[model samples]
Target: MLDLAKLASQIPGISQHFQREMTASRQRLERAQVLIRQTHAKQQDLIELHEQWRDRLIFSTATPVEPLDTRVPITPAPYSHSVFATDGSQISPSHHEIAYCYLINIGRVMLHYGQNLHPLLDSVPEVYYKSEDIYVAKQWGIRVEEWMGYRRTVLESEMLAEMACGWVNPPGPHREPNLALVDGSLVYWFLETLPHDARDRLLPPMQAAWSQLQAAKIPMIGYISASRSLEALNFFRLNACPHPTPNCIVNCSDLLDAQMPCQVVSPLRDVTLWAYLLEPGQRGPLWRSHARILNSYEECHRVYFCYVHVGTEIARVEMPAWVAEDSTLLDQALSLMLAQVYKGYGYPISLSEAHNYAVVKAADRVRFFALLEQEMLKAGLRNVGTSYKEARKRGSIA
Candidate 1:
């Protein structure tokens, strides 16, 4: 029961508010676009400003590796290449359930182009029911769902690296290039906000996966669709600041909200900027992220990203420093991504396929618990029972 009539009554007010916001947003976008053009005209000067403010930036900003306005057109993809993608889903332990356990299912795909080998698609599902595994969330001082999310990310990275390592091209001088892709950001931004012990526990294994991929020279990328990241927009704001020293504490501390100079470019996102700047199949210049979490990552594992226009939408694509620094690999990766997007008609096909395998539907969950209960009964654990609330939600009498 949702009250549809009540919700419908609020639609007019919601539309009015949204319309007002859109009107304001359009004005901001117009001003921001003008600033973007002006900034590009003097990108060299902005680079100097970035160098000066790189250390003092209070918000996350992108460091320009290539010139700010540099846009690279998509090149032709390789005749033969392989794309590997991995995605994961989880079932968090619920107190209302019969078992105190959780599960992680990793769906992986290896798609080969212009090769005789068949595509590999499968999922690896693991259940964590041991006492140590079940209570680890409490040990980490976080909610079970939150802990599972972090663990799932780590597992996804490890699984991607494992599959990439096992990939072997057919024997010939014409051995094709292959790359790995994950669905979201390579940088775990939340890690920095966690407790020190938790941070220490998580960072090592994540870095270890990065190391494994790097050592094997397997180029890995993270693709984000409809990204709302503000790193690039924040960079523009830094450049547009009107203070003499551009120091937040010294100059802009007491300024009125209306008097702020960077307000000209405020409330713009990197995706919006790229949509206006990039042509189809073109990628904006790569920029290194100055996110705090990167401080814990190794130098080679530092996250860098660029925006790509896949003909349908602007996507934020991220990679490690190792992939970004190598020109050949970077070019190949960009082309592979574009090809995948073309195949998918907007998003990457491998990722979409992997997601299909990873998703756990409600019916599957019901079957899982039913089987678990049966097994528990076979083991003579008759005390197992579903919580009253859960039972009531499943079936109710009139």
Candidate 2:
């Protein structure tokens, strides 16, 4: 009874402490509820996305739809006998080089080639160059000889084809019935390179060659060696990554090991491979029949081991299994030839896709003659004393 006022004051302090605890507990409960709601929302979102993707994949078709055919009948056949393989290499005074090679049996042949124009100057001008037209003109001037040489090689190849066809169909002097093998694709390269004026002159020869081949019932097929750049692109796509530049070197096996499938644009209605595969034609509806295999382990192996060391660019997109298989066989043949020809010199010979072009560079043409001689020996033909140096002196180029 004497301390009633002090007791009342103590009661307020105790009430305040109780209120503070209640408030904190309530705030914590509300925060926990908010967190739980957010987690559930995230989980639901993930589930929906997973379901959508799973459904799409389950319903999507596995192969491409066949394309309508409008062109003439063209079919591939197996080799019979007497196949001819041809190749060409181009080296400029500036050290920029290219090689094109191919093989043809009695049936079909494919030819391929590549060119690298090394930068004329290592360093660029400091100031911003304003002469666009003039710059282009200058650049063309520098590359004109190379372009001409390449064109000439293609022309020569066509001439060889004509010669082979003439030999096979009706049979000509110093010619026997044999399959003409060119180390390249079709006549597209020549057609693309020829000037409008010169095209008229060039077309007849090419047409004549093709006609002769057709008359002989010889099928023409192109073979392409696996390229690192091509493999890099394939790996990039398989892993849902960006395509690599030509300069990039990648471990192809590692890419396959990832086992990831990319979201590819469906080129046709029904093909998964077609999403990655390249075809021949430019315009019109994409054809499934023309679709070729892309991103195979075997192809990657070949690309890594064979083409990478030789330094080739991946130009064409689609790679057919038949072509790849044939190319490997051709490569083996060329390798055997190289081993036989340059046994002691140790000068490694590399075969190109276009025209089966082989390259062996030296200080002078004497080395070339020796190589030619060796090739003749392997072919069981006598050296006819046709020296490359003599040909050069006479203004007769290869």
Candidate 3:
């Protein structure tokens, strides 16, 4: 139902737009070279703005390098490591269907490196329709999908930690050291953006899961691919700033020192920055993020991340403060991640398997509705007809 010919005419304009943007981006990248050549004294100075406006300032970054392209090489994955990954999928409630129902399917995978030849896989689907679940959150102004996503994140973390708790190993060559890999960020980022009252309802259980995982002592990594974070770029701006109160509010061009190299650096991404900095199998120095979501974590469980070139793509690897502080465990974690990357085409194989397991197929959806209708009829309740749009979509050829 699209006008293909009309759409074709706009292609040239879109191409030109891309070309224009590319030219600007190249200029910005050249400016970022400033991060590579700065002195230690310039890199470590505090801005004067911190004295006056203490409320908005968060000084968590500790990366002290110039040309912004710094690197440290890491070893490969160990021979006897295990990686456990979990992912979730959901079917949103459809008012057009016979019942107001939603479903969540969690898929988990455990891949062992040395001793085990076969990887373990599992999928669990939970259906929700309880009055409290559907109505309570909605009454508080949370949408159904929003509430479901929150629950799914909690479940994934809880399950990953619970499994790690049971893992025990005696010291040996094949001693199983479990590494829990989360498909996204360690923190429930959505909660940080919500109103205090809204997040209050969700943060407790999520925090509980994080605490459990930290107690388990297994190294956990949250892999973010094509990460959109600007934390690194923000640091670049801070590094080049020459003001007593170095905030971005002042015109950046005027605020930058004449000797600084970052004047050529545009507002680029951490991924691109690291891509230029890190070699294959290398990771940048760890930096703690002052993300608002981190405040909900247990005092000892703050989250931090570092950039790594996993051969093909530069990714941000996040872990708890506990994991970051443990040098041995941290090494094992990085090694396992690199190994998983090697095993997979590019990403972690365990996460890829878990995602595939969690996906809800279209054919399965059709069968699920049929079963729901049958069950209602068996309960002596008449099945409610679906909406006309849905009915038309399911029109019988016969």
> Could you say which candidate leads in lDDT?
1
Error of 1 at 311 (Å): 1.2
For model 2, residues 52-128, the per-residue Cα lDDT tens digits are 43222212111111121111111222222234344544332211111112111111222211212221111111111
List the candidate numbers ranked by TM-score, top first.
1, 3, 2
At residue 201, candidate 2 shows an lDDT of 44
Q: In order, how many clashes per candidate?
A: 0, 35, 17
TM-score of each: 0.93, 0.32, 0.87
All candidates in order of lDDT, best leading: 1, 3, 2
lDDT of 1 by residue, 1-398 (tens): 78998799889999999999888878888888887777777777777887786666556788778877788998978878999999999887898999889999999999999988899899998898897776665765787788788888888888988888777422345568878899999889889878888888778887898788777777889999989898887777765787766566566667764466776756767898788889998999899998888988899889999999899999999999999999988998889988999989899999999998998889878988999999999999988989999999989884
Superposed Cα deviation of residue 272, candidate 3 (Å): 1.1
Candidate 2 ranges with C-alpha deviation above 4 Å: 1-80, 91-142, 171-179, 187-195, 198-204, 227-360, 363-398
The residue-by-residue lDDT of candidate 3 on 15-38, one tens digit each, is 999999888877777666555455
What are the lDDT figures for the candidates, one per model? 0.84, 0.33, 0.73
Ranking 2 against 3 by lDDT, winner: 3
Off by over 4 Å in 3: 39-41, 47-54, 57-70, 169-174, 195-201, 247-264, 396-398
